[model samples]
Each structure stands twice: as C-alpha cells, then as structure tokens.
Target: MRKSKLMVFIISVVVMSLLMVWDMPKVFDNINLGLDLQGGFEIVYEVSPLDGKSEIPEMSAVSKSISKRIDVLGVNEPSIMIEGENRIRVQLAGVQDQDQARRILSSTANMSFRDVNDNLLMDATVIKEGGATLAFQNGIPVVSLKIADQDKFYEVTKELATRGEGKNLIVTWLDFEEGVDSYAKEMEKVAKGEEPAYVSAASVREGINGDAVISGNFTDESARELADLINSGSLPVKMNELYSNVVSAELGEGAYEKTMIAGIIGYIAVVIFMIAMYRLPGVISAFMLFIYLWAVLKVYNLMGGVFTLPGIAALVMGAGMTVDANVITFERIKDELYKGRSVKKAFEEGSQMAFSSIFDSQFTTLIAALVMYWLGTGSVKGFATMLMITIVGTLLITVQVVKFLLGLLVSSGWLDNKKTWFGVSAKHLPDVAKGEERKYFGKFHNVDFMAIFKKVSLLPVAILVIAVAMGVFNSVSGNGFLNLGIDFASGTKITVQSDAPLTVDAIEDKFEEFGYQVSRVQLSGDNNEMASVSIKEVIETEDMYELKEALEAEYGYEPSDSVVTPVVGRELVRNALMACAVAWVAMLAYISFRFKFDYAISCIITLMHDVLLILAIYAIFRIEVESTLVAVVLSIIGYSINSSIVTFDRVREILDGKENAKNPKEYYKTVVNEALRNTGERSLITTITTALPLIALIFLGSPSITGFNTSMLVGILAGAFSSLFLAAPIWYTFRVNKKPTQKKQKNVKKLDEPTEINVPGINS
Candidate 1:
C-alpha cells in the first residue's frame, strides 16, 4: 500500500511537472478560434443551372470553382466548401469588410473577346474546349489554338456575343497558367483597331488541325482572368446568392462571459457539495478536485486546445466527473463506517475500495471519449479531446492527491474524532450506528453458492445483446454509425423572416419555379413567422434577389432578413473524423499500457455500448446525424467511462479484502451491488445536475448549441446506463473465471477472532 501510494505520488508529480513545463497556457492560447469567436464573412450561394435540373454534379463543380477563386483572392484560411448538394458555404476568416469579401466572391470571372460586328471571337469555353498549345520563347508569348469541331464553336461564340460587352467583354481565366499573356496580347491588337484578317500560323504547331495565334498587349488582371478561364472551364451552373452575413466577434463575447460565469459558479457549487458531503475528507477531495481542474486547464492550454463554448461545457462536465471520484470514495468511507470500522481504518479501507471502481469508470469513459474523438468531426472532436485529457487529470488528483491528503489527515490524528467538524456526528457514521456490517458488505463464507448462483439473469443480457444488434444494423443500414451534419455534406440553408406567417410549402413553390429542387423546407421561428428553406443546391446572389422579389410579389412584403448558402463537404468531414479517431485510439492504447488489459477491455466495452445505444436512440428518433452529434458522443463517452472506473475500483477493493471467501461470480455480484449502493445517488445526482445546464441550453441556446445539447442529453443517459450495467458485467465475464483462483483462496484466511483497535473515540 505504501509502495503504491509512493508510486502514485511519483507519477502525479512527474506528469504535472511535464505538463507545466510544456507551457500549456501558451499552447491553448494558439488554438484556432471558431467563426463565432472570431470575425468572418459568411456567404451562402445557391448552385444550380439557369435551367434548374437539381444539377447536383454541376453545383459541386461551381463550388469547386468558387473555392478556387476564393483561394486565389488570398482570403486568410478561407472555408469555401460545398454544403449538401446545392449550396456553397464560404467563410473568410479575419475578413472585417463584408462588402469587400462579397465583391471579391460575387464578381463573375467571365472573359471573352468580341469582333467589331458584335460577333464572339473567343470566350472561356473556347479556351477550355480548344486544343491550345502554349509556350513562352525568348520573352514572346505564343498560343497555338486548335479547333477540331467548328460546329459547336460557332454556337458557343454566338452565345458569348449576346451576353453584352465593356465590363462583360472581360476574358475570365484561372491564375498562373501558361500562354494567357500571349492570348491577351493578340486580343489587345484586335482591340487597337487592327484589320480583321485570317493569319494561318503553322510554325507554332506543325500538324495541328486549325490553329490561331492570339497576341496583344494585355493588363495583369485581364491576363490572369484569361488564364483562370482556360484552367477552369465555364461553370455549368449559375449561382444565385440566397444569403450573406458577416458575423462579428461581438456575438460570441456575451456567450463567452456567460460561460465563464457559469463555469465559476458550477466549480464553486461542486466544491461546496463535496465538502458538505464528507466533512474533512470531503474538504481534501474538493481541494484535489480544484487541483485537477487546474491541471486539466493547464494540459488543455499546453496541448493547444481551442476553448469554444462547447469546449467550455466539456470542461464543466469534466469537473463533474472529478467530483464523481470523490463521491465514490466518500460513499465507500460511509460504507466502511457502517461496517463498524475505526475512522482511520474506514478512511484507508474506503479509499482502497474506491480505487478500482474509480479507475474502471474513468477508463470506460475514456474509451467512449476515444471513440468520439475517433468518429467525431470538427467541434465534436475538439470537445472529446479536452474531456479525455481532463478525465486523466481528474484520476490523478483523485487517486493520488485526494487519497494522499486524506491519508495524511488520518495518520496525523487530524480526524481522530468523528464528531469534530461540519455537523457530522457519531450517528452519521453508518458502522457505529448499525453496530454490524451491512448485508451487502458482510463476508460470505460456506454458503450454498451453487444454489444461489443457479439462475443467471438473461433479461439484462438479452436487452444489451438486442441493443448491440440494433446498433450493428444501424451501422450497416446507412443511417450511419455517427450522424453527419450539413457541415460535412453540401446543401443550402435559407433563413427567411417575414412579418406574417408563411408555410414551407408556399416557399417551396416559389423556389421550384426558379428551377431549384427544394428538399426539406421547414417553418422554424416562433409564431410561424420565419421559414427555413433547405434546398438541394446553394442559392447565389441572383437567386436571392429573385427570391426576395418573388416573396414581395406573393405576400405584398419582402422578408425582413435572409441568408442562403451551401454546407461543408467531404474533405473537412474526413479531417474531423480522423482527428477524433486518432485521439480515441491513442487514449485507448495509452490506458491499456498504463493499466491492466482487463481494465482496458472493460473501458472499451462500456464505451462501445454507450456509443451504440446513443446511435440507436438517435436512429429511433430520426435525428439527422451531424457535427453536434459528434460532440455529444465525445462528452457522453467521457462521462460514462468515468462512472465505470468508479465501479471497477470498488470491485478491486472487495476482491483484495482478507475475507474473500466467495468465488469470482459472488465477488463480482457483491462489487456490482456495492458499486450501485455507493455511487447510485452520486451518479444520478451528477448526471441530473450536469444535464440541467444542457437542458437549459436546449430551451434557450442558439441553433448551433441546440444540436450539441440534444446530443448531450441523449448521450448522458446512454453513458450512465452503460457504465452501470455493461462495463462491470462484461468485465467480470471476460476476466474473472467461473472458479476461484489460487490467489483468491490464499487471501481468504479463516480467522478465529475479529481484530480490534483502540482510539480516543467513545465507541470500541
């Protein structure tokens, strides 16, 4: 025991030291700020052909084109990706001037050369479709254009002439391509009143079909546009801007302040609760919890974790888990007290008894966290990573710091009297008041074990198995293992607020006339005054203007506000999942290395069950799986495993006791029952307490956080259930054999008499 205590001390000190030295504060300081926390431009575009055939593939192409254009615009960390199948959501970070971003994004890069008779000479299509050879030799630009099919060329050229001139005559091109300067120079000569003459040039390309060398004096913009046009062929789809907004950082400031205040209040409340519950021991536990918080923060900072609103919530949740460990330990002390043990003996035995449970619970929560971190994308993964880190920190503080301090207090005679402080009296000690061990904790020897263990409860097992099977079905059925949000798939989101109520069907008809395939249009605002129109394609600037005009024409009033754009795409989704998965797997492997294999296995199983159950619930409810779901899963995983570790620690204690005459099955049952008795109230209370704020968020928070809260509510329930029912039961089945081991037999010595100790307390 001494050696174990010393080992824990050494490990904690080393870990904490390393964390501090790594400058966690600086690391967290550099984390990427989210769009809400930082000022940025958000543009929603509808991508569809003027003909409006849904044009999903065409919309994807337009999104890519626009993204490339934005990239060339040099907006810092531009988030230009496809949303759903129709919209393109573009976010430009650090873009303070919304108008500038809009102008840059909206400016159509259309380039063309027209003849004096208003005939189309060349356009983006001509450059893209034409087999052109480009080379720069001795400072002279040369482009050999080959027109294999002249019939299609004439039709394209005729269409270009009808599109207008002056600003419209500009030739659009991709950036940094070969032969654009040469083409521009040739066009410049024609613009300079040169005679219309056909020049047959075969030196540029020997055996090419029909070749023309375009050379003229061209400006940098014109040349670049020409290059861009050549590189990116004409977009098959036209963009209609459905929505645009430049959300300032100010919106997040209030949320940040509220979160901070709430966190502080929550921290204080948890500490008070802990201290009030267990008196001196509780005080020590509270102190350790504070340290745990500090350590977790430091680690988060050191690891460069960005503290978003969801991240802050995760921190609070982690604090609750930290308090949970103390609750387990204190309850164990109460149990020991009920066993007619001395204060010192109760303290030692309780702490010892609580260790395995705490470890198991935490380990399981960590596993779930890992899965969240594994499968989750974006903010979800971020939350999971932080929660996992804090869980580790909490374990260290609980098992080592809290335990050590409590031991020191008892060893130094600080807690010699049971009725010393905080209104706790001898009556509060369950052991002294009862004068015997409780039925659950009393030693079981020479019992008819076969008779008692004859029947196995298959009901719980059946339910669990069914749940697992359902989860597997969901995984294969394409409802998905995790809910994927619009942030990953490209789509359009149009928020329209009008003075009067409007049905989704009415709005759908208006958009459908404009050739947009409306997917799911739902009325969103209170009093049915606002409508959220989700389309298969992004709505562009022209689309928005037309929609506004149509709305005014139909309802005699335009929408007071509106924003439309595409969702995120596969790339960002892939990255988010990778980040989460890596975090989870790493944590799992780490836990396995740090603890025993059985401990690791229990954690993983509990986590899997929690995740699967959450998925099943979501599937049953038919909630769209999105990024927020990922955050919920991560948070729940941490919470659930934290509970499992607590139970496992208690089981370890019972098994480690001197009077372990029961077989593994009996020992497991005793531990499971004890764990429930010890942590049942704490788990329930903590989960309820933690869930309250989330519930509040669900009712009052913004749309962004609503998803997160919903996920948390479901995940928390699933996590708690799995921790209590699945973690230990599965662990016992796998690790503990049907028969008692030699080590167990040796540990149970048939004592003739009970040992006694004398202290200053009146009871003996």
Candidate 2:
C-alpha cells in the first residue's frame, strides 16, 4: 500500500472522528423533537364561523392568533399549521396537561372592562395583540394590559373617572365564551359545566394611556396564567378540537435512548460487514457512510424538521440504503475484476456502469417518498421527509464521494500490489484463466430465472390467498377489515406511567375492577413501567374525566391520552387508503416515463403483490393499521419498485447493447438471462446489507416503529426476490416473440456456457 494513500485515509478518519465528537452532536442538538418524542399533545381543530354566519372565516388570521397563544403559553416548541381554509393543526411538545392545553387553545379569552355599576366600558378591540403581561403595582401582583387605541381607552376611562369615588371603578373579566361580562352572568355560567374567571378590577381615578395596571386580590401563579391566556388574543372563530394525542415523558425518553442504541449498534454491524466483504473499498465505503450520516443530520437540522421516533426508524432505513449503494458499486467493481480488468480500469468502468442502475433504483424511491410527504401528516410527514433526504444523501456520499476516494487509493498505488484488498481473488482474474467463464464472484449464478419464477411466484400468490381469507375473517369478526390503531379508529386510549412495572393481567384487572372493559393493553418504557390501555367504545368526556382523576389519585399514575372522534376516524381511514393508491400510481407513472410502458406495468403488478401480501400478514396477526401504516405501505412500495427498476435498467442497457451490436448473440431471452445474472448478486447484496440496521431497530429500537421496520424488511426481501425472478420474466413474456435484426457479433461477453439458458416461458 502506498504510504500517501494510507496516511490520507488515516487523516480522514481522525478528522471525521473529531468532527463527530465536537460538531455533529452540536448540530444534531439543533434538531427539534416531535410530540411523540417529547411530552405533549398534537391537536387538529376545525374553526367555524359564528352560529348565525354562513361563510367560513379566514385561516391565516386564525393561525396567527393560535401562534401567538402558543408563544404566550411558554411551550418549548409549538407548531401551528393552517389546513385548507378553516382548519388549524397545533402541536405542542413538552407540555404535560392536555386538558388545560385544549381549554387554553380553544377558549376565546375575551377581556372586558366594566364600570362598578355593571355597565360595559370597553371590549378587547382596544387592547394590543399579545400586549398583556403580569406586572407589579405597589409591591403587589397586578395584571397589566396595553391599549393599542389611546383615544378609545381614554374616552372610556374619562367617563369612568368622572363618576363618584365609590362608583368610579373598572372591573376586568376574562370570558371563556362570548356575551358574558358581568359577575352575575359569569356566576350563572359557572353554575353550568363552564365558567369565566374574574381577573382583576381597578379604580379609574384618572384617564390612562398606552398601558394600565390593575392591582387586585391575586396570586403569582393565577396572575401569570391569566396574563398568558389574555396575551394569546381571542379567536375570531370557534375552534372545535377534532383529534388529539398526548405522549408521556417516560415513553418518549425510553424511545429516544432505545432508538439511539439501535442506530449505533446497527451502524457498527454494517461497518464490520462492509470491511469483511469489500476490504479497502469497504473502508472507503464506511467513510462515505459516515459523511452521509453527518450530512443528512446537518441538513435535517437546517430544514428544521421535528425528529420523531418513526423518523429515527427512517434514519436507520437510510443508513441501510447507503450501504446498499456501496454494495452495488463494489459488486460492479468485483464483476469487472472477474472479467480480467485491471484495478484502476475496473474501478473506473464499474462506477460508471453502476450509475444507471443506482439512479433508477434511487429515483423510484425518491418519487414514492415525495408522494408520501405530500399526502402524509404529522410524524408520517417527518418520516417521508427523512426518506427523501436519505435517498439524495446516499447518491451524493455513497456513490459520488466513495468512488472519488477509492480512486485516490487506486491512483496512489495503494491498491496495485494485490486483488485481495479489493475482495477479488487471483483465480477469478482473466490472466489465470483455465478458460470458459464461471459464475459471478465464485457464487453459482446460472439458475433458470423464468422456470424458478413460475414455481416461486405461487408462494406470494398463496400468501395473498391466505391473506385474503384472513382479511375476510377479520372483517366478519366485528372488527371491520383490519385491527386498526386508534390513530385511524374511534376510541379512547390512555397511556399511563406508574412507579411500578405493569403487566397485562394487572392492567386488565385494574380496568375490570373499575367496571371498565379494557379493549387492548400494550407495554412500553424502561422496565415496562408504562402501559397503554384502550377502550373501543365511545366514553363520554365526563366519564373520561372521572376515570383520569380516580387513576391519578389512587394509583399515582400519570397518564397521557388520545381520543379519535368517529368523524375524524372515518376521514383518517379514507385518506390513508387513498394515499397508498396515490403512492402506487405515482411510482408507476414515474417508472413509465423514465423507462418503457411494459416495465412499468409489470413492476406495478409485483408491487401490488408485495403490498397485498403485507396486508395479509397484518390481518392474520391482527396488527393495528393506523396512520403510520400508510407510511409503511408506501415505503414498501418504494422499495419494491426500486428493486424492479434496477432489474429493468440492466435489461435496457443490455438490449441497447444488443441493438447496437454488429451481430446480436441471441435475442430477448439471452438478453433477459444475462441481465438477471448480472443483477441478481447486486439485488441480494442490497437486500441483506439494508436489512442489517432494520434488524437492530426491530430488536432494540422504539416499539412504536417496529411495525414500520418490519414492513420494510418483508418488502425488501420480497422486492429482491421478485425483481430477479418475477418482474423481468413477466416483462420478457410481453416481448418474447419479437425478432431481433441480424447483426455482427460484438465484444459483449456472455457468462460461461449455461447449463440451460432458454426456459419454457421465454422464447420457447
């Protein structure tokens, strides 16, 4: 090995290590955590015009109002997005009280000042937006209000000041709803289920301008809470909370640590495997992998994406993909060396030839992810975002940067001494030829893909058949078509954190003792100290309130909860189904545009097969199909189409070579055969290499995203199998009878004489 190349590599490693320790963490800390990873509630509220109005209110003004409210609430990081024309989505991370948050967000805190005679003097229109704060007056607590309109406020105060000293007083009231400002009316409202709180009243001995501080009977906490709510500004329209969820801190922290561990372990395993497989090229791949991770995280920080548990799963998935790209490039290099090319020539041409397949594969996945991001919401959006970033980053770091660095080593003469460092044995090189070509990489590659395809295709079909029966059974068993999670189904779920570990039986017993039937029970957090207990029936808000109080008081358990109303539940299910379809069709269109129509048609069929088979598995197992399920299904589609695209790209390259040849060797069958042989190793290598990190996530990562990881795993394996055997064979069946033009033999070398090249289904 050349000392220069070795030193360069050593220096790069040291610099990356230093950057990882000192810079990456600092950059990553800038990444925001989602509600599921921090403790808080995410709610989507539908705003409506007043009861007598017929038109919808403007959403931009509503969003601004809610944003100011969240800022005043002192939330760590709150996100407010306007949907369509009149809906608002608010996500508050690290806020504990869900009930209080809902009240504060939806309540119209209409501040009013009335004279002591119970006559209204001024309304909230005169106050500046976000101009309320808790101040001190004469060493006592007071609520301060800033007036935006000096003339209006002064006119009101001047009238009040002219009254006798005993009657000249301004009383402040924060109305929870409209039309109630007096103490009597507020008391009457309080007699019902709701009430407006009285803030403070002050003497208006003189006209005031700019700001007014009212000192009264007030405590520090109450004064501050009222000030914050008042500063939030009143909503112009009524906000009805439609969907909401609160995540517990214990669960969030546990998921955080477990996912990080899964990432580190999975990454280390991938590094070890790469070095074992590709030697020096593997080391270069590892460096590029490091850089890829660093770059993606930095970009994520810059994009201001909120990191969720599912997003962590996406990042792990991304790492596996980076490994896949590295594997593809290195495998091509090995193929070149096996054909007797020198190290430098192999590296050069191999990277060049590998680009087409990689581009097609990555491009298909990117298209699907884009569709997912566009249609998905909340954490699903976050996952799709990371998926896109990962794909782009893989193309940059794994493909472009790895090749550049490996070329440096090759050019510096570090790789000139032996083929072992490049994972190519001396016997495989052409110079040692005992002549007649052999299987690729010392592995048997002469399987009859068409024949095997006909036989093996039935497995997924059979799985689909079973899946169909299972789905029918599930549908008939009073459970709709799938065991849907609360995210897509109507129910009340309470996630509880106790000082002690919770067992299913114990949880069931507790609910049973309380005369509440537990529909489902799941455990999370370290040592199983947390449990999510759900009830399928629609429990009243009052009942849920009593239950929460009882559980908290008696068991000292802190429970975060979610409720999906029937209307929203129906909408979720419909949208998720629609998203799955849209993702499939979008991929088909992109593939069709990029390649030929036949390849696109066959790829979508195999893609559908993969999706149906996964659904069948979920049905048989009664897995919950929730919002994240949509993300998982799309990711699988992405992966399935990706594998199919790789095979087709190879087929196209070969067909083009055949057409340009002076003499075409055989025709479509031979072309298809060679294409499959060339790509089968690349397919298998990618599948196995990508599965490494997922395996870690399945075992050691957050339990929440285990479904997503498992789905991707199944799809990847199925994709690799179908891409090599099914997709190509099916496409070949479409064009099997087409005749090729006669031409002279060109330089393209076919693999060693096949035991049997032509099969029954292909140009028999």
Candidate 3:
C-alpha cells in the first residue's frame, strides 16, 4: 500500500507538471488585455432620444451600431456593452487616434435633404438599414443610398426641381445639428473660402427617384467611410460622454512591464518564504502555488476576462490567501505532531480540524469579492473579478489538491516518525505514552494576548477617533472630507510624458499657452519626465483636441487623459459606498452562520476598524481617494476576517473541551488567550507572506498602482493587529459578560461530574 501510494503521488506530480508547462503560454496568449494595459480608451455615454417625445432607443441597436462604426476605424476586438437603461460603454483597445475615434463613435449620422431655402425636407428615416453603398459617379466617389420611401424622396426632389437654375438644388447634409447647421450657412462659409459643412449639393433634374446619390469631391477612403456610417443604422439616440479613460501606448507598455516585474518578484519572495518557514509542507505549497496561479489564469482566460493592473494586484492578494490557508493547515499539523502523534495520524486529524477555519475565511472574502464585482466599475470590477477567481482557485487547490498530495506523502510511511519534516522540533514534542500535557511550541506561546488586548485595542480606537475629527475639521474648513480623484469627482486629468524632465511650473506654463490653467500638477518617474495635471472643470471636446495636439507636439508623445462628468462622479461615489456596505453585511451574516453572533460581531468590528483605520490614514495624509480605494477597503474587509476566524475557530475548539468548567467566566478568558497564543504565529506568517508581494508592488510597480498597494499594505498590518489583539478580546468580553440561562447552568452542573470529553478536533 505504501509503494502504491508513492507511485500515485509521483504520477500525479508528473501529470500536473506536464499540463502546466503545456498550457501556461497558451493561457497568457488567450487572455484579454484591458485598455489600461494595452493602451486605448474606454468611454461611458449617457444616451438620450433624438426626438423629445420618442422613447429611448433600444440599447442593443445602439450597441450594434457602435460596433459597426468601430469596424470603420479597423480596430481589433473592441468591446461595446450597454450599461443600465440609457448608458452605453465602449472600450476600444489599441486605437491610435483617440480624438478621431471618439468623434466617429458619437457622431449622429443623421443624413438630411434640404431645398435651396435650407428648409429640411426629409431625414435619414428614408434610408434603409443596410442600403447605403459606395459608388463612383463620373470618376468621383459617391455614397448611393437605397431610399426606404420613394415618394418622400420624389417629393423632396420635386421641390428642388421647381426652384429655378442654381436654386433648383437638393442639398445633402451629414450630422446636421438642429438649430445649428444649415445649407445656407455652409454655402456662406464656402463663399468665405472656408470648408463647407454639408457633404454635397446636386441639381435635381426630375422628380423621379427610387435612390439618391450623394456626390462631394470625395476620396475613396472618405466615400467608403461615409457609406459605412450610413449603412450602419443611424444612432436613434444622442450620446453624451459622461466618463472617458484614455491611455497612450507608451504608458500602457511601461505600466504592464513594471507591474509584471513587481508581480514576479512578489511571487518569488512568497514562494521562498513558504519553503523556508514550513519546510517540506512549504515545498508542497510552493509547488501547489504554481499550480494555483496557472489554474486561475486558465479559468480567467476561459471566462474571457481582461487582465488589468488591479487584476494583477488581486492575483498577488490571492497568492497571499492561498499562503494563509497552507500556513493554517501546516500549523495545525505541527500542533498535532507536538502531541507525539505519528505523521499520518497528525496529517489526518490536522486536515480535518483546519477545514472549518479555511472555509470560513475564504467564504467571507468571497462575499466581499462578489459585492465588489456587482457594484464596481472599470478597473475595480477587474480587480474584483480576478479576486473571485483566485479565491475559488485557492480554496480548491489548497483544500483538495494540497491535502491530497500531502496525504499521499504521509501514507507512503516514509515520513512516519520525522515530525521535524513538518517544522516540529523533537524537544517540543510531549511523551503521549507517559500522559504528558500537550504544549504550544509556537513563538508567541508564552505571550498572554488577552493581558495586553486592552492597551492595543485603544490604539485603533484612538486612530478612528482622530480620523473622524480630521474629517469634521476638513468639512468645516471647506476642504472635503477626503481628497477625491477624477474617478469620484468630476474633473479632467492629463498625464504627459516627455524625453526631458518636467516641472510643475513648466507644465503650468504649457497649459497657459493653451489659454487654460491647471488646478493641480504632480511630477513622477525616475527623472520627473512624467506629469499628472488635473483641471477642476471638464475640458470641452474641441479644447481637448487642441490641448492633446499641443502637448503631443511639445512632449513628442500624445498625453493620456481622463474626463469625468459630475453625473458619473456621483454615481461612482454611490456605487463604492454600496459595495462596501453590502460587503460588510454579507461578511457579517456569513461569519454569524459559520460561528456565533458574538464571533460575527467581533469580526465585523475588527473589519470596520481596519477599513476606518485605512480611511483615517488617507484622510490625515491626504491621499487621493479614488475607485481603487474602494477595491482596497473591500479587499481588506474580506481578508482581515481571516485571522479573526482562525483564532475564533481555536477558541471554539478549546471551549468545547471546557464546556462545564467551574468558573465559566475565567475559563472563557483562558480559552481565548490560549486560542490567541496557539494561532498567533500562523496569523503573523500569513500576513508576512501576503505583505511580501504588496511591498514589492509599492516599491517597484507602476506609479499608477502605488496608491492601491500602499492602501492594501496599511490595511494588512491593521488587520493582523486588530485580529490578534482586538477581535478575540471583544469576543471574550461578550461571552463572559453575558448572563447564562438557567438551562445552561443545569447543563454545566450535569456535566460537572469528572468525565472525559473527546472533542473531534486536533487538540481534542
């Protein structure tokens, strides 16, 4: 049986290795890249009906029309999604001319016919859906339209024909805005030697017409585009850009490279830490972490998910989560080994005992990830997506695959007596045959966590109070509670890169040259060659074009820009609050179900503490509060509960054994302290592993994600502190202070008789 188990383990390793090597490259190749990663733009437009009385156009039709219009630009893999009742989101990746792309996309291809008097006769309603075709009339390219109504066209032609000489003309106009554009105005511009606004004007020889030919001095490319726009059904609704994020290719490539390097470095550090700390089990988890990543990437690619900067951050966080699970299990096994149990017996009992803690932690985090996905937009949603994938992947790989591999190794009988292989030292092991008491061999085994809980808990509370006071002060002083970024506040942000170092004054002077003053400017990059400029007022579309051109000419590269309207900013703020609230409620309910209400309340308080602490830091430090901060808070809410749950799981196990203790109050405190001492090392190790990659990101990753990494790093430390010192103590207080019912007293008295209780966990 030992030989067979060994052979099965070897075969499984070989199979997994083969699969990973074969599919890794293909998985990366298949995954989609978001605009932030690949360089392009994403815009959400609020659509309104063209005519006031008309109902909003079907979103599907609008999306389809936009898709067809995108094809005219020859873009690859454009994403057009209809959001809500009247908003359409268009994401175009790898488009060079953002200004032109935006213009083409939102252009109302409302073709119209007018008499010489410039009075409208017929609109685009007369044209068929797919009837417009490119043609040549006497060597000049033209757009031929198959009229849907022959009679209306004939009547328009007849009116034009009745007007004599040059006045007997049918004027064709494209994108004629009501109360703004007219054929007479366009002809007046032509007379003044400026370009005509109308597309063409042709003499109407007769009133007989089934089709219409629009002839302007059109180039082949221009004619084809005009025909394509007409053929692609006109947008029945007007589109107004509410939010847009545009990135330059140079910026995208730089961000992707820097973030990837940071991620690889972080992953390497985590793997090394795991192997060194957990010994042989660490090696198994190390190997499994590789499999975990490959599996997550494979699943994400299959789901057609786009990889973003935040998504990469989530992947790193997921690695931390997986490490936490492995550490928890390994710690349990070591505890069992400390009791002088055989390796196989220890592994069996430890795996079973660690199941509840792992499940509760991962599930609570899963709840937060789901809420973020539902309410977050843009990169926040991407972060949530990758987080969800990682959670599911970590749970499956760590719980099932890691256990199975470890099981095979244990069952092979090769590791039967070597407790040290699982990081247990011989000196720490008790002599079970001699009836010695089981001991904790962890580093914090001597520290009474409850003794110092009051002092340490005061720290977070004071910080929270300071944060609130700062918020109130800021509000009174007219500075907002937190510094809001473009994602949560309406503004224009432009990021420009130059070959030469840039200064705030230089950039301000440049903006002044364009007749505008920037609200604020900050320089980054190793040589200060990049500048982020913000404007309180959203720049008009025409002004943005001129600014983009002037900046590109000066910097030798086009600057990336983001414009957010007040409407989108308000919506984003609401959604972020909603995401956080829903995450809290969901985690509270789940923790309550898995444990008890007191445990749930304590965990929730700890989570809120971590979130508020981070917010307070942000408020005091004046960090830009943006959508990414939402991802950070929710992630902390999900993850901070882990240590609390692990400790509480231990408390429950210890309490079950002392259910009928003589002094229930003193025993409750004792159990919590014991649980803390027992689980303290694993919790610290989990945070360290998690922090390793986040630290790398903070120092080495793109400047764009620096805020995200820093916030997460702060939350991680706060979470570990609160879970260790605050949550357990809070739970202890709740349990000891509550009065027990009469039935419980009787039960305690009944079980008071000296008898053994064999609890079904490791310590039991």
Best by lDDT: 3
User: Model 2: C-alpha RMSD to truth?
Assistant: 8.5
| Per-residue C-alpha lDDT of model 2 across residues 1-764, encoded as one tens digit per residue | 47877688667667877877788877767878887666678889988885567876678877887887787668866788775466678989888788778878887787778765566778888888777788887778887878899898988888888989767878786653345446666556658956346666567888886688766667887678778887777777788888887777767777777877887788788888889888988887877787888889899988877887657657766776777777778888898888777788888888898888888888888877776678766555677899999999988767877776777678777676567788877665666345645434445367667668778878887887777787788678777677776666678888877777778998888777768877778678877888878777667878778877877875697466678665555554465566667877877787788887778888888887777777877877887766665556666676667777878988888777445244343466677787788778767777777788788878988885577678767766766777777888888876654465478878977778766667888967
Count of backbone clashes, every candidate in sequence: 85, 4, 0
Candidate 2 has a TM-score of 0.87
Residue 745's lDDT in candidate 3: 44
- 2 versus 3: better lDDT goes to: 3
User: Candidate 1: misplaced stretches above 4 Å?
Assistant: 1-33, 36-276, 279-304, 342-345, 352-381, 395-414, 419-425, 428-485, 494-536, 548-603, 656-671, 699-703, 732-764
Question: Which residue runs of candidate 2 sit more than 4 Å off their true CA positions?
Answer: 1-17, 50-58, 114-120, 128-131, 135-140, 146-185, 188-218, 432-442, 566-586, 657-670, 737-764
lDDT of 1 by residue, 371-469 (tens): 656665445566778878877887776667777766755665555565334224454345545464444432222233223322333443555566556
Using lDDT as the yardstick, the better of models 1 and 3 is 3
Candidate 2 local Cα displacement, residue 337, angstroms: 1.1
Instruction: Find the candidate with the highest TM-score and give its number.
Output: 3
lDDT, candidate 3, residue 354? 93
Q: Global lDDT for candidate 3?
A: 0.82
TM-score of each: 0.56, 0.87, 0.90
In order, what lDDT does every prediction score?
0.58, 0.75, 0.82
Residues 1-764 of candidate 3: C-alpha lDDT, one tens digit per residue: 99999999999999999999999989878877877677788788999888564787678988888888898888877788665688887888888576778878998888788776777888888888788899988888898888889998888787677878999887888777768877778888889988898888889878957887888878998888888888776677788888887766655666677887897898899889888887899988989998999999999988888787677768877888888999989988988888778788899999999998898888888888898888776666778889989989978876789999999989899898777888777778888888987775678878888889866767877887888888889989987888777667678879899999888899999998887767667656667787778876788989989999999998998787777766766676577678878887888888788778889889888887888899899988888787667667766776787678888889888877456447876788778888988899988898999899889888998776687789899988988888889999999889877776665444344565688778789558
